[model samples]
Target chain A: MKKRAVAYLFILPAALVLGIFMFYPLAYSFMISFTQWDLSATRTYVGLSNYRALIVSPDFWNSVLYTVYYVLGVLPVSLVIGLGLALLLRDSSMRGVGFFRTIYFMPVVTSPIAAAMGFSWIFHTQLGYANHLIDSFGGEPVNWLTNYNGIFQLLFDRFGVELPRVLQGPSVALTVIILLGIWQNIGYATVVYLAGLQGIPQTYYEAARIDGANWGKSFRRITLPLLSPTTLFLLVMFTILSFQVFGPVQVMTPQGGPLQTTSVIVFRLYQQAFAFYRFGYASAMAFLAFSMILIITLMQLKYIERRVHYD
Target chain B: MTKRHVTLAIKYAVLAAGAIIMLFPFYWALSTSFKELRDIYFEPYGMFPTNPTFSNYISVFSKAPFGRYLLNSLVVAAGTTFLQLVTACLSAYAFARMRFRGREIIFFLFLATMMIPQQILMIPQYLVVMRLGMGDTYQGLILPYAATAVSIFFLRQFFRTIPKDFEDAAIIDGCGPLRILRYVFIPLSKPALATISIFVFMWSWNNYFWPLLIVDSTEMRTIQLGLALFRTEGGIQWGEFMAGTVISTLPILILYFIAQKQFVKGITLTGMKG
Candidate 1:
C-alpha cells in the first residue's frame, strides 16, 4: 500500500496537468466543434453545421489544395537532396565532414520565424539578393512573394497552353514558402538519413563490391533498400510538419499572400478562431485537419509496413 | 590513385558548395545587420559590409520593447523547461520503477495524448486558460506545456535502460523513492537529462504560435513574436529587421554551438525511437 501510494504521488502532477490541459481540452474541443460559440456567453449547439460549411466552402478547399501543394513541393525534393547530402558526407574519414554537417544542421535548429524573415529579405523581389543575382545574369527579376500565378500555369502559358484550374501548381508565393520548408527540412532529413546510413554494416558494401557491383549498382541494390525505413520515417514526419506549417506563412505573407494563395489550413483556422472570433467553426476546421493528417499518417504506416525490413 | 584523388576532390567541391548554400542566409543576415541603410540599398552591393556598424542592433532595442521580449522569453522558456523536467522526471520514474495498479493502461493513456496535436487543443485551451484568468500571463504560457508526453516517454525509456543494481543498492541504504531519483537516477542520467533539457529549452524558446494566441500585450510577448511583429511594424527597416533576427536567433545558436552533440543526439534519439 505504501509503495502504491508513492507511485501515485509520483504520477500525480503530470497526470493532473495532462488531464486538465490535453485530455480535457481534447474532449472540450470536440464538443465545441458542434456548437456556435463565438467567445460569447452563449454556445448554442449547431449539430454539424460547422463541418457542413467547411465541406462546401471554397476557401477551405483552397486552403487544403495549397497545403497539398506545399507538402508535395517540399517532400520529394528535400528527400532527394537530403539523401544526396547524406551520401556525400557519409565517410567521416573525410576532413571537414563534421563542419559540413554542422553547417547543414544550423537551419534545423533555427527558429522558423527568424529563418522566414531571412528568406523574405533574400527573396524580397526588388532589393533582395535573389533579384540582384538575376540582374547580374541579365535575367528579368521574378516577383517571388506577390505573384499569385501558379508556376505550372505560367510555364504552360509560355508554350501557349492553358492548364485546368486544379491542374495549376502552387502559386509563386506558395512556392516560395515551399522553398523555405524544403530548406529547413533537408538538414533534418540528412541527419536522419546519415544515422540510417551508419546502421548499414560496412560488410554489405564490401560484399557487393566483391560481386563486381559498380557504384550505381551497389547503391541501387544495397543503399536504397536499406534506407526505406528512414525514408518512410522522413516522409511521415515531413508530411506532418509541412501540413502544420503556419509560422513562415504568417511571417512572409502576413495576409496569406496575393489572393490568399498561401493560406494553409492552420492559418485559415487561426483566422477563423482569432481574427473572426468564430471559435466553434475554427474547432471544426481543426478536427477536419487533424483527421486528414491522421488518415494520411496511418495510410503511410500501413503501406510502408509490409516493405520495412527489420534486419 | 589519381582517379581516387579526383573523385575525392569532386566530393569536397560538392560538399563545399552545399556548405556555402546552407550558410549563406545566415551570412547575409549577419552582413546586412552590420551595414548602413545606404549600403543595404546601394546598387552593385558589396558582398561584405563596407563599414560595419552596431547602430542597427542598438536601434533594434531603442525602436521597441525588445529587451522586455527577451526577458519574457527567458522566463517562459526557463519556467517551462524547469516544470517539464520536474514532471517528466517524476512520471518517468514512476512508469519505469513503480508497479502501481493500472500502470500499463495509464502509460498507454499518456502515450495516446502525443497524437493530440497542439492545434486541436488550442481553442479550448485558450478558453480554459482565459477562464482560469491566465491569459497574457506567464502561467498561461508555461502551464499548458508543463507535461508533454514526449518528454515523459523519452525519460521513461532512458530510466528503464539504467541498471537495477543502483536502485537496489539505494534501497538497501534506506533511500526512499524520492532520494533514489534525486541521487541515483538523476546523477547517473545527466547526459540524457541534458539532451531533454536542451531540446525543451530550444523548443520553448522558438515557440511562437502559442504565445501569439495567449499573449495580447507587448509586455508579454516572446522574442519570436516580437521579431515577427517588428517585421510588420518596422516596415522595410531591413537593417534593424536583420538585427532583430540576429538577436532573436543568437541565444539558440549559441546553445547549439555549445551543446551541438546533445542537439544532434536528441534528434537521432527522437527520430528513431519516435
Candidate 2:
C-alpha cells in the first residue's frame, strides 16, 4: 500500500497537468462543438447544428479540399527528394556530406514563421529573386504567389491545349506553399532516411555486387525493400503534419491568397475562431479535422504495423 | 578517373547543388537584412551586399519591445523546460520502474494524448485559460506544456533501458525511491534529459499559435508573436522584416549549431522509434 502510494505520488504532477490542460480541454472542446457561444453570451445547446452547418458550408468544404491538395502535393515529393538526398549522402566517401547535411537541416531547426518570411520574400512578385532569375533568363516574370492559375493548365496553354478547370490541378499560389512545405520537410526526411540507410548492413550490398548486380539493381533489390519501413513511417508522419499546415499560409498569404486557395483546414479554423469569433463553429470544425486525422492515422497504423520490419 | 570515381563525383555534385538550394534562402535573408533599401531595390538577387548596414536591426529594436519579447520567451521556455523535466522524470520513473494498480492503463492513456493534435485543443484551452484569468500570463503558457506526453514517453523509454543492478546498488545504500531516482537514474540518463530539454526549450521558444491566442498585450508577446506583429505593422519593409527574422532565428540557430550532434541524435532517436 505504501509503495503504491509512492508510485502514485511520482505520477501526481504529470497527471495534474495533463488533466487540467489536455484531457479537460479535449472534453471541453467536444462539448463546445455542440453549443452556440459567441464569447459574450451564455452557451445555448444546438446539438448537431454546428456539425451540420460545417458539413454543408462551402468554405468548410473548400478548406478540406485545400488540405487534401496540400497533403498530396507535399508528401510524395518530400519523400522522393528526401530519399534521393539520403542515398546521395549515405556514401561515407563523400567528404563534404556532413557539411551539406547540416546546411540542409538548417531550415528544419529554424522557426516556421522565419522560414515563411524567407519564402514570402523569395516568391514576392515585384522584388523576388524568382522573378529576377526568370527575367535574367529572358522569360516573363511569373506571379508566383498571387497567380491563381493552375501550373499544368499554364503549361498546357503554352502548347495551345486548354484543360478543364477541374482538371487544372493545384493553383499557383498553393504550389508556392507546397514547394515551401517540401523544402521545410525534405531535410528531416533525408536525415531520418539516412539513418535508416546506415542501419542496413553492408554485406547485402557487397553480396549483390559480387553476384554481378549493378548500382541500380542493387538499389532496387536491396535498398528499396530495406527502406520500406522508413518510407511508410515518413509517409504517415508527413500526411498528418501536412494536414496541420498553417504557419506558411498565415505568414505568406494572410488572406488565404487570391481566391482563398491556400486556406488550409487549420488556417481556416484559426480564422473562424479568432478572426470571425465563431468559436462554437470553429470548435466543430476542429473536431472534424481531428476525427479525420485520427481515423487516417489509426487506419494506416493498423494496415502498416505488420509490414514494418524492426530489423 | 574510373567509372566508379566519376559516379562518386557526380554524387558530390548533386549533393552540393541540393545544399545550395537548401541554403540560398538563409543567404538571401542575411543579405537583405544587412543591405540598404537602395541596394535591396537595385540588386535583390545579389550574392553579396554592396553596402551593409545595421539600420534594419536598429529599427526593429526601436519599433517594438523586441528585447522584452526575447526575455519573456526565454523565461517561458526555460520555465517550461525545467518543469517538464521534473514532471517527466518523476512520472516516467514511476511508469517504467514501479509496479502498481492502473499502471498500464494510466501509461496507455498518457501515450494516447500524443495522438490528439493541438488544433483540436486550441479553442478550449484558450477558453479555459481565459476563464481562469491566466490569459497573457506566463503560467498559462508554461503550465500546460509542462506535462508533455512526448517528453514523458521519451524519458520512460530511457528509464526502462537502465539496468536493474544500478537501482539495486542504490537501494542497498539506504536510499529511498526518490533518492534512487535522483542518484541513480538521472545521472545515467543525462543524454535523454538533455535531448528533452533542448526539444522542450526550442519548442516553447518557437511556439506561435498558442502564444498568438494567449497574448494580447505587447508586454506578454513572445519573440515569434513579435515577429508576426512586425510583419503586419511594417508595410513591405523587407529589410527590417528580414532583420527581425534574423533576430528571432539567430539564437535558436546558435543553440542548434553548438549542440548539433545532440539535436541530430534526439531527432533520429524519436524518428526511428516512431
Candidate 3:
C-alpha cells in the first residue's frame, strides 16, 4: 500500500494534466458532437444530425478533398527529394555535408508562420520573384495564389481546350500550399533518412559490389530494401503532420483561399469553431478528421511492420 | 574525367541546386527586410538592395507591441517547458523505477495519447479553458502543454538506461523517490533532459494554432501570432513583415545553432519512437 501510494504520487501530476487536457476533451468533444451548443447558447441534443449534415455539406466534403489532395501532393515528392539528398550527403567521404545539412534544416526549425509569410511574398502576384522568373523566360506572369482554377485546367484553357470541371487538378492556390508543404518537410525527411542511412552497414554494399552489382542495381536491390523502415517511419510522421497543417493556410490564405480551394479540414475546423462559433458542428468534423488520420496511421503501421526488415 | 569523378561531380551539382532552392526564401527575406519600400515595390525582382536600410526593422518595432509579444512568447515557452519538465520527470521516474500495480497500464495510457494529435482536442480544450475562465491568460496558453506524453515517454526511456546501482545507493542513503530522482537520475540523465527541454521549448515557442485560439488580446499574442497579425493588419508591407519574421525566428535559430546536436538527436528520436 505504501509503495502504491508513492507510485501514485509520481504519476498524479501528468495524469491530471493529460486527463484535463487530452482524455477529457476527447470524451467531451464526442459528447458535444451530438449537440447543438453554440458558445453563447443553451445546449440542445441533436442525434447524429451534425455528422449527417456533413455528409451533404459541400464545404465539409471540399475540406476533405483538399486535405487528401495535399497529402498526395506533398508526400511522394518530398520523400523522393529527401531520399536523393540523403543519399548524396550520406557518403562518409563527403565534405561540407554538415553545412549543407544545416542549411537544408534551417527552415524546418524556423517558425512555420514566418516561413508562410515569406512564401506568400514569394508567390506575390506582381512583385513576386516567381512571376519575375516567368517574365524573364518570355512567359506571362502567373497569379499563383489568387488563381482559383486548377493548374491543369488553366493550362488546357490557355490552349483554348476546355476540360470538364471534374478533370481539373488541384487549384493554383493549393498547389502553392502543397509546394510550401514539400519545402518545409523535405529537410525533416532528409535528416531522418540520413540518420537511417548512417545506420546501414558498409558491408552490405561491399558484398553487393563484389557480386558485380552496378550502382543502379545496388541501389535498387540494397538501398531501397534497407531504407524501407525509414521510409515507413517518415510516411507515418508526415501523414499526421500533414493532416494537422493549419498555420500556413491560416497565415497565407486566411479566408481558406479564393473559392475555398485550399480549405483543408483543420482550417475548416478552425473556421467553424472560432470564426463561425459552430462548436457542435466543428466537434463532429474534428471526430471525422481524427478518425480518418487514425485509420491511415493504423493501416500504415500494419502494412509497414510486415514489410520492413530490421537487417 | 573517370566515371566515379563524373558521378561525384553530379552529386555535388544536385546537392548544390537543392541547397539553393532551400536557402533562397531565407536569403530573400533577409534581403527584403533590409530594402526600402521603394526598392521592394519598384524593383520587384531585386536580388540585393542597392542601399540597405534599418527602416523596416524600425517600422516593425514602432507599429506593434512587438516587444511585448516577444516577452509573452518567452514567458509562455519557458513556463510550458518548465512545467512539462517537472511533470514529465516525476512521471518518467515512476514509470521507469517504481514497482507497483497498474503502472504498465498507466504508462500505456500515456503512450496511447501521443498518437492523439492536438487538432482533435482543440475545440473542446478551448471550451474547457473558457469554462474555467482561464481564457486570454498565459495559463490558457501554457497549461495544456504542462504535461506532454512524448516528453514523459522519451525521458522514461532515458532514465531506464541509467544503471540501477546509483539509484540503489541513493535509496540506501535514506533518500526518498523524489530525492533519488533529484540526486541520481537527474544528474545522469542531463543530455536526455536537455533534449526534451529543447524540444518542448521550440515546440511551444513556435506554437501558433493554440495561441491563435486562446489569446485574443494584443498584449497576450505570441511572436508567431504577432507576425501573422503584422501580415494581415499592416497589409503587404513586405519590408516590415520580413523584418518581423526575422525577429520572430532569430532567437530560435540561434538556439538551434547553439544546440544543433540535441535538436538533431531529438528529431531523429522523435521520428523513430514518436
Q: What is the TM-score of each candidate against the true structure?
A: 0.98, 0.97, 0.97
Give each prediction's DockQ, rounded to 2 decimals.
0.66, 0.66, 0.69
The residue pairs found clashing in candidate 1 are none
Candidates arranged by DockQ, highest first: 3, 2, 1
Evaluate candidate 2 and give its CAPRI docking class based on DockQ.
medium
Q: Model 3, residue B267: what's the lDDT?
A: 70
Task: After the best TM-score superposition of candidate 3, give how far the Cα of residue A16 lies from its true spot, in angstroms.
Answer: 1.0
lDDT of each candidate versus the true structure = 0.91, 0.88, 0.88
Candidate 2 achieves a global lDDT of 0.88
Per-residue lDDT tens digits for candidate 1, residues B1-274, read 6999999999999989888888888998999999998898873257888888999999899888899999999999999989999999999999999999999999999999988878999999999999999999999999998988888999999999999999999999999999999999999889988998888888889999999999999999999999999988834489899999999999999999999999988866665211
Clashing pairs in 2: none
> Interface root mean square deviation of every model, in Å?
2.3, 2.3, 2.1
| Per-residue lDDT of candidate 1, residues A70-148 (tens digit) | 9999999999999999999999998989999999999988999999999999998878998888888999999999999
Give DockQ: model 3. Answer: 0.69
- Candidate 2 lDDT, tens digit per residue, A182-238? 888888899989988988999998999999999899998789888888888888888
When 1 and 2 are scored with lDDT, the better candidate is 1
- Model 3: clashing residue pairs? none
